[model samples]
Target chain A: MKKLLDDPAQAVTDSLRGFGLAHADQISVHTEPNFVTRAGGTPAGQVAVISGGGSGHEPLHAGFVGAGMLDAAVPGEVFTSPTPDQVLAAVQAADAGAGVLLIVKNYTGDVLNFETAAELAEAEGIEVASVLVNDDVAVEDSLYTAGRRGVAGTLVVEKVAGAAAARGASLAEVAALAERVVAGVRSMGVALTACTVPHVGRPSFDLADDEVEIGIGIHGEPGRQRVQAAGASDITRRLVDSVLDDIDLAAGARVLLFVNGMGGTPASELYVVYGVARQMLADQGVEVVRSLVGSYVTSLEMQGVSVTVAVLDDELLELWDAPVRTPALTW
Target chain B: MKKLLDDPAQAVTDSLRGFGLAHADQISVHTEPNFVTRAGGTPAGQVAVISGGGSGHEPLHAGFVGAGMLDAAVPGEVFTSPTPDQVLAAVQAADAGAGVLLIVKNYTGDVLNFETAAELAEAEGIEVASVLVNDDVAVEDSLYTAGRRGVAGTLVVEKVAGAAAARGASLAEVAALAERVVAGVRSMGVALTACTVPHVGRPSFDLADDEVEIGIGIHGEPGRQRVQAAGASDITRRLVDSVLDDIDLAAGARVLLFVNGMGGTPASELYVVYGVARQMLADQGVEVVRSLVGSYVTSLEMQGVSVTVAVLDDELLELWDAPVRTPALTW
Candidate 1:
């Protein structure tokens, strides 16, 4: 594989440095502990939005910290959630007296560490709230497991609640908005090939050229099933149908449609999927009020796409339409 | 070549259908004519924001259609611009009684088609204005055979101007703001590997495993030169410095930085780039006001990153901070 870098081991460090230098105004080196946050000093009475997970998903937590998104995003190594101590520091750094909201995906390690930090923050009078994001419809819940893993849908919650926070909506309002976004959104994905984690240095999954895994998670977790590769129209229909089946979207209810590239699918292909997706909905008498198609949320160079839809109401629409300026998301 | 598809020809069409089905509420299908617009119908007398280009840049023209962004977008095939007719129709669809502003990249086909449509709109008595985005510093001259192609910086123009438009700013105001965004923004890129342009069944360029191409265009265009593959930090610094040198960024001036993935790169490396990038900028006394790091704009799976910095003033910053609701971008 051809790449522009010296040592693979140093690749992550190199990228972080570049991120800091590029955004020296909004972000800086929080070295003693590590993370990226607004360089212009934290504001008081603001609910600190602290979220972190793996490093491979750029513009997620870190790229989101700005006017209307996240206050601080603690990016861990690729596909690895930050440790408890790191989460704790991020929470502390983002704290501006109004308390912080910990946005943690429902992954095992991420949830556990963040929940513990929430408790610790509460003990320290920081007052923290967390609404676990489990928008992935492909996952099955086991009583022993940490529930559904958060996927691309976290972006919806972050943007919605982040907007609410930016509007000076109370913490309750922000938390409530986040929950509504979580409740309304559903996502499902498929993978044509397993992506090799950077450190692992090998293919994550060994699928044959002719096979494609349906309903796969972003982290290379097992998919719902493997199937023969189908046409874009067929695949697009299946993915959207699966997600809609997971949630009973009212026939006339407005929705915000998102066809996310799982890192590798190109925009052209995504547009093709969008074409089919638009037709399928019309065939079903559903009226899409709004739409989003792109790599807004992504997996690391995974060759596939995920379909996400959020049932929208007036309030949700307002929040969705709100202005925001962040590194990953703009406008 | 582990793509999950029966054939490549139907990729774009199928994807669009799937996209429609998923967000059936907010958007409707444009069968006879391709293109999706707002559900409530384009308001009369509202200045419509219209943008389109080639297809692979997903979530760009299409996803960014809503209250604060684009009114409608026309999508073409991958890496190929839409026909003059398609663009004209979208302009018609998006045009409320007020008129329309065409936000076009500096690509030859896009500019030509959009320019033609502007004439057609004037014939229809519909007011039209345009801002040519030529933010790529790599492609220096505004006058060239292949002039500076628009890159991720287009998103900023869209967002900033979209905000101004949403705030009831006049067509002149919106057009002027967009030009300012285009003027303030500058981007440069480097590619590590050539991308496969599906139809060609070959790579756009060939780079030795240890070599990197700097100042490359998103559409697999050649760059300034090729050098040995250096660390991500080194490459990012060079990319940043290259842009800085071309534009004399005032010391202590606040700027919005963007580090974008050229399709195939992983975020793990992006963070490393950010870290070093932050330190370097601080050392230069350049303040990174706001930053966006992600795959906002991308080539078809090219392994590299492009750096974009938009010089920000108070008004521009406010406009940047304004809320926008589009499929690809949300605040």
Candidate 2:
């Protein structure tokens, strides 16, 4: 696959430069590299929430940085986890006197690297806590891999804890909030098209035009299964059904619904999904108190969508009600 | 062009359903037809901020509904403007006591329709104000074709104004703040691939693998001109330079920079662009106080990036700092 680039390795740096040029008022690039933060300010006495991973998902780590969300975000190359050193640097930069918490999606490399970075930060006297978001209900109780591969559900945990941290919640409180969000949330996705990582220059996988893969991880990694393309309403049901079954967001529970595009599906389709999903939830006696429909979290350019449900409580709802300003999801 | 769908007309509604399902908590279908909001319990009196356009851009109009941002967002079919009635209904739902402000991107159809809606709202005794965002430097500043097409910069205006409104700033205040963001922001983009609108089922334009369309619009419209595809470093420079020259974010001035993906470029490339932009701004002694990088707004699946700069002031900064919890950007 041909792509516009000087060098594949330099792609991330170049992309960050473009990002800096466009949103320089809300964020700043750290001198220590790969670390970005809200312009000129650090969270004070609040848990400095930090998260990072492979670079492909735009706005996830970086766009999430601001007052109500992540204090700092570090991005590695496409599909490659941020190095331990990068994670350590982000933690150091975001750390106020309060401490820093790393929200790691449950990917092996990310977990290992962030854990290593936490140790390094601890060595430097920076109080660091780690919260793993393993909310993807798609990855079954596996014999091999970890439980579920975290996909779009990371955004929910990030926002919930980010809101708490923004409210001056302590590191422990923020960590607990994050863990609760992870526990309450469940996500599942399908991809209609395989993404072409610029460096690779080809589709990650090959499927006929009518086929879509279910349980797709963001990176186009081989998913749990492939299925014939179905209608959007049907797809939403399937995704939500899996998530509902996984988390048992029982009848009458207050839920936060997120119909997230895996990057490619348009808002037009997402909106349609919303109507069907609302009806489905209502039929199940689940009350959706709030909903987010869009590409807040995404897989590259995969033409599919994911369903994320967060069983909410008063506290979680309050946290959710807190304001946030990120580049992607702003209120 | 190949796509995963049964029929073209069903794409938008179908997608909306899926979107609603995902973010069911903070959003819900505006049962009165084509609008969406945070699941339930509309926070009344907040200056109802409604933004909409064609459907391709996800997490833009709809994903941005919650406490601090838009009260409702309506989506049209793929690349098709929402009808006036849809806008009117959204305005009605959002108008509590304070009134409603329309944040319209400068596309001709959107402007005309939103303008009509504003009139309808005023007739209904709901105070209404509107700020048209025309920040795309790529479009020729001719008396021709209504003003310059509002590109990704619309997001900035919506966020600042939405935040102001969420804080109980009146319609006038929100409108004025929207203008401030509009005045300070400028964006220019280049696309490597011609996006295909779903209904159209064909590429909007033909761009060879090594060709780039500079000055692209948000609707997959052809850019000002077609040129050979260049490296990310070079493309970043061109787009950023266009924005910088269009608006003099003078040396030593702190500005918010936004590098928006036209919906296709990988975040890896975005980071690289961010780095180049950082150094470029430094070279001119322009201090980037805040930065936003990602596909905050998009033009379907075009491999392109737009650079938007919002020159910040004290008031804009506070407005930017206000708390907001929307599906797309929360803080």
Candidate 3:
């Protein structure tokens, strides 16, 4: 594959090493545990927030680590879950006098390892709470997930929860906020093309030139169905309708609409999707309070787009507006 | 060819309509002249900064319209320069009591149209100045450019110049700062594969499975040379070496390193490039004071990366660090 990599096996570690130095002003890298923590450390009395998953979805867990977002991010290999020991190290390093909160995505491997780490942290007399993010409405079952896979909505969760923690909320309060955000958020993705993992050295799947996969998972897992490729508005309608059907919004409800590119998609297209989504939402009388259009959480070089809508209340909106200073996102 | 667009001919206007609606909070769109201006007009006495070019480079001219960036942005069709009338409209709309400044890239069409707009604005008794950015070190002359095609460095120019204008600098001061930024900045890009325009319905160019286009232009035009694919470090080294060779740095010089993805590359890979770039700069005793890694200026869905190095003096560095509140960039 013509990827900008050295060795497939050493990609993760080498990337992290580079990541740490590139963002050294904002974070510190711990190679032994393979985690990134805020450079200045979390406040003494503020709850520490941590998250992680496979490595390929960049700027997710690691790029979100900073003063207002994540306290620490533990990274695994491209599509592999981080070991429990790695998660434990992140928890121990991030925990101050306040308790720790683990934001785990709803994947089987990630769930097991994070849960085990939570138990280990508790055994060490450190209070820990976990929130599982399962906001992707794309599929109910996948090769690596049980119910639904966590997708871009995890970004919304981390932002809101991290804001709560930054505001000196308790561990229970932060975890509760994360779960509340997850409950109100729904995401669905459509892939125009498959992605090639460096190690795999080939595309994850193949499709006819005129075909596309609707509601595809972030890992390139099968979606609801394949169909003839359509225009931006049509594809956006499918994703937006699926989300609107899954969630109930009052006539004048507000939401933070996030139109995310699946790695290789351009911002021009994302804005097109956002434009179509905004018109659709207006037709349905759902107001878009705030919107983000770009690649926040992405698969590696997958050509597609994912739309996540989080129904927002005043409190949630306030938290989202709070200043966040991360490498991937900053305000 | 799969693309998230409606009619290929109407793609530019449609995307702009969507963009205006999505960012209505920050900017307003005018169709007659075809430009996006600040929703809240510029301050009465502040120098009004404006920039524009062909569309498809999202977050460039349009997305950069905000409080601390451009006062207006004019757009043309995909890879086609905006008409003189369009540029004149933006100049008229954004001109405060003080004056107006236009930032034009080095492409021939962009330069001619913007220069004509300046003459028109001056005829109307509005003070105006223009700066032409030609920072790409890839090729001296190309299909669309006379000398070098302005690429990602235009973002730096707009940002620094925007900050200066926001500080109430005169049009002359703002234009001078922009010229200084262009003088110190150098950039080069490499493309792994070609992009397919919606209307074209085919790849812009073809590449064998194992080959890559080195020093490729943002429009997929030819670069310095083509070679077999290389590793990230080796590719980065070639780019960095070319830039270093073109510019001379003092023993303890500082620079701003911007590693931009050409729409389709991932952050993980960019960070890997940044790592190698930082080490190489350190080896040369050039310290990096600031760094930005993401897709800022881009070709639509082109799978590539571009490296830009701007040798910064204290004044330029301060202007860069100054707060910016654009849709695509914020400090």
Candidate 4:
């Protein structure tokens, strides 16, 4: 594999070391039991928000750790769930007097691990609440997930929930806000190429040159269908249709349309997909009031795109627009 | 070629439409002699700062058009320079009562076309000054350039110069600042795979499975060497050595170290490269006071990375820290 890595075994630790160094003013990295917490520990009397998953899909949990987003992020090995101890460490390090909220993606491993961590934290007399994110409309169950897998919409959940916490919401309020975002958001992805995990030293799947996978999961799990490669608009239509069909929106509903790159796709292509998806929503009389277009969440270097539609009310819009500063996201 | 594109011919236009739509609050796209201008137009007395080049590099010229950045940006066809007419249109649209400054990369076509546009703008009674950026240390001359090719360091020039213009510096002052940045900055890149132009229907260059092209140009041009693939640390060391060797920096020099991904690389890998590069600089007694790590400048889905080091004074540091709000970058 032609990846820029030192020992594949040391990939996560080394990358985290670099991440911490690059954003030293914003975050502090903890080894031994790997986790990252905001440089200035969580403030007193404010709910602490945290999230994590596999390592390859970067700028997700860890990159979002800062003043207005995640208070801490626990990172597992590439494409593997973080252990219970790792998550527990993050919780202990981040919790202030206001308590803590864990935003767990809906994968089976992630769910079980974060649950264990929450229990562990509670045993230590720390108040903890967990909200599961299952926003992907692509598949009901996949390789690592027993339900709709959390995908790009995880970013929306973290941002809105983090903003609520930053605004001094209680633990219950933050957890509820996260679940609200999970309910309002839906995402679907397509993969043009499979990504190679460094340790595996090969692509997760073999896709024919003229083929594309629709409704693919973030970890290269099988999608809903495999089909012939088509034009950008045709591919985009499939994703937009799946997401729009899953969400119940009225003619005047307002939303945030996010076009995310799977990884290797260029920004120009992401914008093209964004334009097509925006127009499709407009045709359905749904107004796209807020938009995000970039590769905030990705599967290593997979070349594809995911379209996320989040039904937004005034409250959600205000939270999204709230000032945020993180390595991966800021406003 | 597997790419997210409609007709290859419409790639630039379609993408620009989406960009303008996505950032309507920040920029306005103009066609028929296409260019992008600040949404509110350049301030009445602030010298207008503008930059442009071939289109595949998204978030470069176009993405940086905002309040604290470029007043306008001209984009050309993929891998081709913008026409003189296109540059002239941007100059006309962005010129405030003060003047306009064009930041041109050192590529021959960009230099010639921008020169013609400056002349045309001057003939129309608008003041114009041009700054040429040639920061790539990979080579002295190549297929598309007469001197060292400008690469990621172009970002350093545009950002610092744009900030100066935003602060109401005169055209001369902005141009001089841009030149100062060009003189202090140096960059070098390595590509693991060649990027295919959409219309080309094939990779720009072929490489064996275990080989890498060192010091490759953004356009897939020949570089300093092609060698067997190596670990991230070794590759980063080579790039750092070349950049540090080309520039004379004594102990205790303060610099901004930017590690930019060439589109297809992941953030994790970029950070891996960043960590190694930063450590090497520290070993040499050069302190990295400011850091930028991402795909701000890129080739079209080229799987590679570039390292840029720009010496900074207090003035440049202040300008770099100045608030910038754009689609691709914000602070």
Candidate 5:
């Protein structure tokens, strides 16, 4: 309830205006359609990469738009999916002669809307491909998702796929690379506190001071279990175990590790979690090839952390290391 | 206090272990003296830049250690100043016979400890120069200091000064550039709620359900005043006005605007503040040459925002745009 905002209804639109101004050198905003496209128009023969979901997850889709990442990002209201029309506008704005790729999270509404948008774009003779990111290992099914929740790994997908697109990959090649990245990655999260949607004016869930939710989704949906709060090491072990269980990796497998913060968690704690998780992976004889630690996908003010591990091959590692100039994931 | 940590006493050291492991390619950790130094040592003739302070304001000193930034960082216990021995160790590790520059915040404890360290280093024949950043316009003095508290502007100092040092500036030159950056910058912040230090296990201060602390310090130190909670625009106006008053700017002045989140606030809200801040600056006819909107300097889980504006000339602007590969501020 203590959020900084003028009106809850205006939060998404107003924030986008701010994003446009702050990153004017790298992005342009389409006010009417509520999408952000690359400031410089797409190259004539490079595949356009577009991604979006709800707005509360900062720097996910919007902040990732730039030279080596997303071409366009269409954000909806906080925790609400964008309409098909909005997604179509983003596609049209980002499309050059090459093609367009829609990077959709596995959320039911997001999948439906983005599919509709892809169909609309195809009808207009714009070649398009689509991929779903369902890397969250938290639950088999969730309140708003059909199969699995797309959590922090969406960022991994966007980064690798964006790099591929930037390298002039065709629509089919970019979508295939995105799917491979999705299949190779798994993520799990835990929340010590629930987040309040600005419009709701209350936390989405209630928990006692000493309780914690393990395997939680980004939207405060119930995870696999809620238990008494544990220390950073124990919590990290649980999330890492969950992710490791879902992924197939041999001993000595090199992987990329991502430790994502759930908004309110400080970087110090995230590092603590990272230390524990890295130790855990080392114990399992898996080599961490690369690591990213920070708030990439966040649930608004939820205090927690998510651990993601993406099995990395030489090609995938090369793509991950490829220069990215997005606001959040530049390197 | 609900923090993600195994032991409150070991938080700082344990977190650094993770930082070292995660950024092993770029940094190396010295556990005994408790400092992080660049894994790839400083260039033979490059002046080494080092910074440090309390542990909780993460990604400040530690995350800024790498190429084009701090050569070393010494972290103390949470909200506590590091010992002179620790700072001296960092200075020694980073010193490559070219000299060393210590960037200290304006907190009394930090200044005292860093000064002691400088004397220690000089006695060891390492030429040392120190610069104090006190750019907070919140008050003339605060709970922990005799003068203005160094807040978000410290990042600007580290960035520009570190760039100068990377360019092989002499110790005197780096120190002078850091001082100039401090003089050119002013910042103000507001806290929506008090933060709980893990060891303290309680909120630092109390506020009513509908109250806010204006001009708040990063350590939750008392600021100018508290008042009934206001909308983001009104609050942004108050903070922007305070910073604007303390700095000299003509109508056509070009400045770099930084809107930082104090840990728990979501990026959406930070952008709201940024949008308002950018508009206010434009209304005053000040052109924003560059803008950084994120949680660069943060209080631990305190919900709030801080605004900083640094007057920029061609030299400072060029340095600001120089490539930086720190863990946090990479571009």
Candidate 6:
């Protein structure tokens, strides 16, 4: 596979080294255990928010670490879950005596590892709470996940919960807010091309040029269906319909519509998808109160897009609108 | 070619529709003589900063069209220059009583059209100044440009100039600052794969599986040479060396090192490149006081990157740090 990397085994470490250097003012990277923490450490007596998973979906856990977001982010090798020790270290480093909140995606490996880490942190006399995010509406079970996979909607969970934590909420309050977000958010994706894992040096799956996978997962897992390639509007309609049908939103429900690009898609195409999706929601009488369109959570240069809709209450909207300062996301 | 588009011809218009819808709070979209302007129009007596070019390199012209940046941006068809009429319309819409400044990339079509637009605005009794950006250090001449082709460094110019204009700099002062940026900045890129323009339906150039083009232009124009694929460090070293060599920098020079991803490359790869480039600069005694990473300027899903080094004086540094609130960039 053609990739800009050195030793395939060193991809994660090398990239993290660079990441720490480029964003030194915002975060500090810890080796050995491998976790990134806020530069000045978590504020005293503030509930620390932490998240992690595989490394490929960049700007996800790591990029979101800063003032109003993750206090620490632990990254595993590309497409592989971080070890329990890594997560425990992140928890220890981030806890500032107010406790910690862990946002774990529903993947089996991630859930187990983070749970183990939480247990380990609790044993050390530190308060800890864990919330599972399973927002993907595509499938009931996947190769790597037992429940619905956590795709782009993980971003919504992190953003809302991070805001709560940043405002000095307790661990229980932040955990409750995260669970509320998980209940309100839903996501679905389509892949035009598969991404290759650096170590494997081959595409994770094979997709014919004239076909597209609908409801695809971030790790190239099997999706709900595969169909002949179609135009943007038709493809977008399928995604929007599936997501809306699954969510129990009423006619006047207000929501945040996020159109996220899976690595390789350009901003122009993302905008096109956003316009089509926005109109589709409006036709259903759903008011799109806030919008996010960009490549935030991705699948290692995979050419695709994911549509996420999160029902926004007044409190949720306030949290979403709260100021956030991070490397990948800032306002 | 696999792309997220409908009728290839509608790519620009459709994408703009989505962009306008997604960012209605920040900017307004105008059709017929298509252009994008700040939502509330330019502030009276404030010098208007405007820029435009082909459509493919997104977030360059349009994404930078909010507060503290461009007052207006015009987009042409993919890889094609904006017509003189379109540029004229943008200038007219963005101009307040303080006149306007046009930032043009050093391309044959872009230069001619923007110049024509300036003359047209002058005929209408509006003061206008133009600055040409030719920062690419790849070749003295290229297929679409008479001299060096403008590449990623155009961002530095627009950002610095836009900040000046926002701070109420005169038309002449903004123009002069833009020119100074042009003189101090230099950039070079490497393309791992070619991109397919929507209407063209074919890769811009051909390359073997194990080949890479060094010193490449944004439009897939031939670069300095094609060599066997190498690891990230080797490739990044070549790019950093070429840019530093072209610009005359002393040992203690302070610069802004920008590592921009061509659309298809992932963030992981970009930081790898940034880390390498930053170290190389440090080894040469040049301090990277500021950094901007990610895909700001892109060549429609091309998998590659460009390194931009701009000498920053106290004034330029202050301007670079000025608040900018656009869709793609905000602080």
lDDT of 5 at A290: 97
TM-score for chain A, candidates 1 onward in order: 0.94, 0.95, 0.99, 0.99, 0.99, 0.99
| Poorest stretch of ten by lDDT in candidate 3 chain B | B6-15
lDDT of 2 by residue, A1-331 (tens): 4354677666667666656556666777664468788886675677888888887777687888887888899888788899999998888778888988889987888889999999999999999889888787776533223666777889888888889888888889999988988888988888888888767778888988778787878877767678777776667778778877887666789988887777766555566667777788899999988877666676666677778888889999998878777656566
TM-score of 6: 0.99
Report the Cα RMSD per candidate: 5.5, 5.3, 1.1, 0.7, 1.0, 0.7
Where in model 6 is the C-alpha error above 4 Å?
none
lDDT of 6 by residue, B135-252 (tens): 9999998999999998888888889988998898999999999999999999999999999999999999998999999988998999999999999999999999999888999999
What is the DockQ of the complex in model 6?
0.84
Top candidate (DockQ): 4
Q: For each candidate, what TM-score against the reference?
A: 0.75, 0.77, 0.99, 0.99, 0.99, 0.99
DockQ, per-model, please?
Answer: 0.36, 0.35, 0.75, 0.86, 0.85, 0.84
CA error at residue A77 for candidate 5, angstroms:
0.6
- Provide the overall lDDT of each model, using Cα atoms, as 2-decimal numbers: 0.75, 0.77, 0.90, 0.93, 0.91, 0.93
What lDDT score is found at residue B307 in candidate 6?
A: 95
Clash number for each model: 81, 99, 0, 0, 0, 0
Candidate 2 displacement at residue A185 in angstroms: 4.1
TM-score computed on alpha carbons, candidate 4: 0.99
Higher DockQ: candidate 2 or 4? Answer: 4
Writing each residue's lDDT as its tens digit, candidate 3 over A224-301 gives 999999999999999999999999998899999999999999888888888899999999999999988888888899
Report the candidate with higher TM-score, 3 versus 4.
4
Native contact share for candidate 1: 0.64
Best to worst by lDDT, what's the order? Answer: 6, 4, 5, 3, 2, 1
Native-interface RMSD of candidate 5? 0.7
Query: Backbone clash tally for model 3?
Result: 0
